[model samples]
Target chain A: MTWNSWFSHGAPTAGFTGGPSIVSRNNAVCNIYVRGGDNALWQKAFFNGAWHPWGRHNDGAVLASEPALGSMGPNHEHIFVRGTDGAVWSKAWNGAGGWSGWFSHAAPVAGLTGGPAIVSRNNTVCNIYVRGGDNALWQRAFFNGSWHPWGRHNDGAVLASEPALGSMGANHEHVFVRGTDGAVWSKAWNGAGGWSGWFSHGAPAGGMIGGPTIVSRNSGVCNIYVRGTDNALWQKAYFDGSWHAWGRHDDGAVLASEPALGSMGPSHEHVFVRGTDSAVWSKAWSLVPTVILHLKVLTNPTSFTVDQMVASMRDVYASRGINVAVGSRETLDLPLLTDVDVSTCIMGTTTAEQNQLFANRNGVGANHVVAYFVRSTNPPGNGCAAHPAGRPGCVVSSTSSSWTLGHEIGHVLGLPHVSPSDRLMMGNGTWNITNPPPDLIDTERATMDTSPLTVNI
Target chain B: MPVTMRDVRAVLDPDEVDYSAGARLGPEAFDYLLALVRDTDPGLAAKAAYLAGVIRGERSEEVVAAAAASEDALVRVAAASAAALLAPASASRVLNDLVVDQDSGVQKLALRSVPADPSPELRSRVREVSAGAAEPGLRAMADNVLRGLH
Candidate 1:
């Protein structure tokens, strides 16, 4: 979805200093917080389709840096900022009772310079990432019921700018930053796999002028924007699982500082920036196919375990509002089908060739899809999403990409190997594709959402 | 008997096993790595299988044999590497099983592990894998095995 033209919200702000922080408690209520010209927090509310007038917040909160906000859940809001005293502080709002007293989270041993970056996938977990005084990344978390002590990432990266944080699920987190070399870099945590080694995302042609800002449309997508060396907004996105090349926003909204992103769950998102005039401006956009797909899996065990692959598919699909559950897991027991050449299936031989596979495979037609786990598939694939006519399921290799399950199921729903190698239906060797949270493109999502197996929630 | 997570942890740290190569880790370490051939954690079990192959000592061939029988493809992949390192006579039995493995990766490595002067049966098996392997890389590797025939 393309962003709408920038909307200048002069809002009686004679001169806003930093990038604005914005979030939606739900789809209908948007709260945007910023540092007013008086070096204090200012907020404007958007509800029922109109943005309200700006007003002083936190009883004229004295701010030393930009304010960052996260929507824990509908009606639950949390905001964080670096105080003038060099300590990061936090406050909360629960839609009705007004703001809670500001709480200091203390500071990293090396202290910090940029506004604290924050993200939350649910109400119980929130993370605050900041650029330490040493230029390393420091983080503290609010988990379960209390705040945890500050910690530092051991990635050995020296940041040239602040960090941008995003979460795909409750346990997954992705953070991006501009390194001292002026190139964009990222690190990820997949809940089970832990933190990945830092990888480069390339640099804006004009070079990076500010820290990146990111927002996820769902579990399968991440959109990141940074102020470029060219003095305009540049963006790179991981959509439906594939990474898109970096490009400019083209809205002509030149930034005086970095940008901030906010969203109301999937489909609804906004980008706010401090324009050259020091006035807060924002552009909002929405995506399509806000629907849920359901598929139940039946496993046929092999020596290789299916837990990690199954769990990953569940999490990735869950983010896109798809529900996947294992129905009945049993062994295939038949050696012929268990270790057979699947060339005809992957390439579509004929009905008879397809019959060779589905003849003994059971657990069909329960308003969900089925997957047969086999020891292996000949012609060298970890899994085959291919089936003939009425089979409507996939045969998976015992040790395959966790995405192989989803990629194969995507076939039954009318998706093909139609996108990048990082996509769910990547045509090449999927086992080698290390990119996580694979993309399910808009067209593919629309197709999958309309399948007979999907019941809109 | 199946190896539990605790049982494996008691022997040696999983991460540290990768560094055990040529370290002459004592018998306890081999015992732990041996039992791990049946560990429920397939990924870790595969690593144990790899460690057993690279650090072939004190009945390590038994570890390689058990790994070949594992339903997990990764363990079998490690088994191929282990078998490749063993003396030709000792590695033949398991090498034959992996040569026909359903996973192309296992088949490719197993085919490459086949002794320079393969038995008539092994030569025929290499021909079969070269013909049926789905991946081009594996197919090419299998062909290389046939090319090296004396």
Candidate 2:
């Protein structure tokens, strides 16, 4: 069976409860931890290119709720589980060695209502937040290989469930919880200054029963997801220095528990939940509503103008969920530029070498797509998404039609060629530039949306 | 999560993948290979099976056996090929079963996997298929395996 069936058949969630937690070290490695029917902490890891069988981590200790996971070192992973004894127990795993036996973090004034929210920074410090017996928020941290004593951050608002945590930058962190009044309330920690007063996010989630799941897309933006009173998934993001109004994903499923979210890359977030059908359902969001491509023309053949090339691609890609615009343009002086030179410079080069060249010649900022186009009559396959350009960037043909331009850019945006002929990434390397016909497929859209450089047009 | 087509495509390049690297990766790599053989993507499953054969140790052969019985012909062919490359004699039973597969492509690959002087069962099966198989390619492959038996 193809993995496509796994999406419909779902991950093996035969007897899972509470919210699932997912974390990743990179796009290629991720782990999902959940409470098993036996009330033990079970996790499935995605390593290399496939999901490993689910393994129990708590050494048969029955957990009272779900498990929260974080990494304290590049090779070290920690899973904090609330044991049936009401004390939070922890287990450590090293990439070099396997798992260490569960250790206790002592109780935090009282037992936890559910699992705590866990996050790690620079593999040096880890913070855990849980709801205390007093229905107030409590916190603890791990630093210098030791567990810090529990501290209270009582935000006056009565808490009913777990508190979610997200870090905006090196030292800035945000903790969000559902107040007794059903409003989403948050307080932040500025590593240099300490905790701040509870700020009401003002989103009424009146019937939210569990903690919210939060993830930062980058240092500048973060998103929060919660199950509304209507049992629908709702989201709100903090972007451009302010919080946006809450919006519904209209996910079209009744969630059985609080959602779990993690970013696969910048501008790409995936939300997971246990559906009423007892299956895991995941939805992906690509926050990049548009993208700017910086074109550095080594030389354009007299046959076609760069503007014509841009207009052709813009006309084709605009309808397929990406707005293409030029953020900057420049031309370079060379003694003699030839098609063979362009091909040799790109195809024969390594990504590091290409990146070095771009770094020396272009001042394009991070999160900006940059490409070097040449007036080549014989570019690699008429165009190429040469990885050496480095920054979600590439090298392409200046003479190719808008279709080829769009196809190469698609590669820049993390798309791969598909077998079908009707799509933009047709296997035969042909595309319909005139009609373009929504050539971008669903997988391509999802991949593009998750691009770290994807942004509003 | 199931492996995606994109994931399968990522490792298709022979130059990009180090076939022996998985064996050196310890348990985590072994777990990955185990899951990959059962992947829904037949191409990925086939490739992983081939890699498992190259990495030959512990549960690698077990993974190849499971993949050899997969419903997808491509996966079964890959498993057969891997089995031939690794423990050909141990793969004799699987090759015997595949030598008569309904899919001619599977039959050809399975016949090609027969070890020198393979089990009588595999040799007899290959003989039968070579005599009656409709596809010339399968017939040729079966005859080739029969030559080795002789």
Candidate 3:
């Protein structure tokens, strides 16, 4: 949840005129492509645990604006930019074929006024957003083994800057632009195969000064980072089925150009902005990974039942951006499993019967967590997060407090008990925590972020 | 050394009292909590009530029952749940009071606290709630519980 300080990553100064498009290929290698002062596309790669020296990959191709970068299935990367002739050109690279020579897709007759934004839905499909010569938004795609023709999708809004794109789902994209009205306007595919009208997300009071950069953390969640008129970094987050107000991230790093956002899956999202010093400065948010839990209910207590426990866990985990409630739930009529004997699961140990119950996950992912709801643990114990090694889960007492479920599961995700009752990992009985929403500190968040059970939101 | 009401309130003030960890306070703490539940601060009263529920004694059920009457919705809701853990002597009436509480959340946990085989009076109250409750969500919950009983 908190961002790291602004680190320049040894950003090149001269000829860095303005650029910094960042992408992670296969979530392993990060290639930061920027339009160099020499009007050519250059890159600095981070792989094998080190940053490589800056190198040009465009074969001295003259670019009219900054370059956009995207990846397809971890094997291929595509870079799109405006050529000297006002046409949009691309240079593709594949793991097998290395880098290919630049080729022109031929721009709209009106021509491209800014760089393109690229999103790859799958290995074969990619969509590009651009600011057209008419000052409206336009797009094209590469699917069915060929490039589609230039098409405009402004919904009657004129743009003052280039557009940023978010992937809502396969075959659906959301586009946001800094409209000439000094507001952020969005037009998205309705998911039912239709386009939505332009909707304004309201800008900062002084209005925005540059284009917006976006990174979709998942299907329903995306965040827009931009430089406001005050020269500060401002962001608008869309998640939980709605858009929140624009909040400023005042880290004291003044933005000099439009910001660009990229992420390595769920690890973190880095916002790269050309700072006042004309160097690419970046800050990143350590994103939380989802904890998928499968519950085995024993006797549903009068209070704090398994269903209520899961709902409470969802709200607790939301503080760190984990939608643990978004997973599937079904009723299986297995009588014996439905009514289990947790009698032997005492203290910090699980019984053989408990292990047998867990053994039949019924195709649940190994990385997913399973919670066994029982009537009670050993005397004086409401739950225990210990199971046989290699099987990660916990046993919960049906009478445990609302925070106990999350507390035990937090143990599964590498959290240790702390003294304060106002925390989720409180060693004391969760039943007595005064805090309604217990805290999960950053270090605990980092520990959970690295758990294999986590898939980034 | 005897546990004073101040000692009980001080321990309960900053964080919650988890006697379950180790009986730092005892059945003696229950009477002190009962006095503190009358504190003007409803938040402190709510905390006193929950700690009383945790340290159930002769007065624990009544402590939550009194908390169920606190003007604070949070206090009432917390009592609605804590009532399930204390004395079953007055459990039905306390739960029935909570099930029809003005707060839907209180009604929810109270409905949830209904035993697998409920007393006829509790079952009858559930039937009334299922037919007509202010919150549709609460009504649906009662309806579902009624169906499962069948």
Candidate 4:
């Protein structure tokens, strides 16, 4: 629940001038780089349980600010820095080979204020951005084994601070910068669509200080965190086709540095910033619970189709903050099996003699909840769907509501009947679609989120 | 000293026993473990049956087979998984019954445990379930087993 801290040799002896940049290679090793007190780049390596001593890599160039870091391939890393000459310098570190001495780009940057923002689309191409002398953005890229000449992204807005970079997919990458107006403006590059004009994602309520930091949860969702006008931390997310309103998360602590974002796990985002106390601080944001349910039709249904049921179920659970993924439906050979107790419906088969009829079946994942929808129940009240606690699947009647599916599956997912008996888990053969029961309690939410079959996020 | 029912009970308590010591347990442990397959605590009985397979041998196989046939769903599920570790031909019959178990847990474990080289009879059973089982969970599992078997 707490971030583990490691103090490498040559840690910032002076206050960190700009945000330190770190990137993981092959997700197995993380290389961290910072501007040491002497104002040059110093780096350390973390891999296979041991940290290599900090080593300086800058080639006698006086760095004006922090360096940007990105990965090119398995164990390959690239670092970009703004030099005292106002020129952008670059270096590469290969796990197999050694360091590529700092090389100056063909064109010296005009204004070159802060560290450049750099990102790579896997091992194919790397893009770097820096503010130019005119206060506009300049960009260059490395592709097909060569560096392209720097060009202007001059979208008519002047940048006042450093830039942050993030890649949402193979073909998409975005750059965020603090505008002269203290607002955050973004311009994106789509592999097929080229560059887009700069757009505003809103700025801090107070004003902006340093650059913004961006991280992608997946190919479609990206979040940006920045220091607000009031020195508080603010965040906005680009998800589900539109940008979300900015949300504040300063927790009343003023920040002294730009934020850095990364994912510790699927759906888990951590934003790191420097508090006014000079100590590093982190806040984590987690996505909602996502689960997949596999339905097996054991009998022909007369009322509703399988897709209709799945859609209804998704809508019902989505309202409760749960993301439901219904797997493909498979038609089984027999009707739902009934137990000697008419109240309980058997899931797979009632007799051992029935085992031989189902050996070659496949497609069920370990985390999948298997539900068998049978025709009519013996005495059909709300139908007889039953499931044991902590099981992977359950049995439900075809005539049951989507709420019934949620209830029975909730039981398989480890939620017991709600004690008040007025909720969705209430087992009185009745449900209120419009009012429904309250959302799953915290403990139940945790159980559902941690279930092995659920998606990691 | 020979392992006793006390030792078996101790091992079944997750808090008290070291499960990783399953291989180090001696032959005497099997008899006691077999008796615990029907222990009053279904969870304990399930753990006992599973350990029987982990300490696998002549006696472990017998316990696994017997536990597979037990009426207790927990025991049956454990037995189904344990039986899969034994000689497929000898344990195939027990696995056949478990694959279609009324309990989803038992059915899942049984379907998962069916051997890659199951006997022809077991293969036939798997095919039947793959195509006819009322629950897609088992059917999906059956389909996976059939893919591997063929």
TM score of chain A per candidate = 0.62, 0.64, 0.65, 0.62
> Per-prediction interface RMSD?
12.2, 16.4, 10.7, 15.9
lDDT of 2 by residue, B15-104 (tens): 113344334443334456667778785545665776667666666677778888899765776676677765656778668788888865
- Of candidates 4 and 3, the better by DockQ: 3
Q: Considering DockQ, which of the candidate structures 2 and 4 is the better prediction for this target?
A: 4
Highest lDDT: give the candidate number: 3
Instruction: Show model 2 residue runs off by greater than 4 Å.
Output: A1-14, A204-209, A286-457, B1-150
Model 3 CA lDDT for position B82: 67
Cα deviation at A252, candidate 3, in Å, is 1.8
Candidate with the greatest TM-score versus the true structure:
3
- Tens-place lDDT per residue, model 1, A1-457, is 3355799876435456767888777878888788777878888888988988998774656888878888788878888988888999888898688789898988999999778888786778888999999989999988878889999987798988888888888788988988877888899987789899998888777787877778886788788888887778888889756888999877667787788787765766788887777777888776432212223223344443576667777666666656565555555445434433454354354344235765544645544566767544542235666666565666776656567777777777777665365666766545535477777667776787788765432
- Angstrom error of the Cα, residue A374, model 3: value is 30
The DockQ value obtained for model 2 is: 0.01
Off by over 4 Å in 3: A287-457, B1-150
Error of 4 at A58 (Å): 7.7
* lDDT of candidate model 3 versus the reference: 0.72
Q: Which ranking of candidates, highest lDDT first?
A: 3, 1, 2, 4
TM-score per candidate, chains pooled: 0.48, 0.50, 0.52, 0.49
Model 4 chain A scores worst on lDDT over the 10 consecutive residues at A335-344
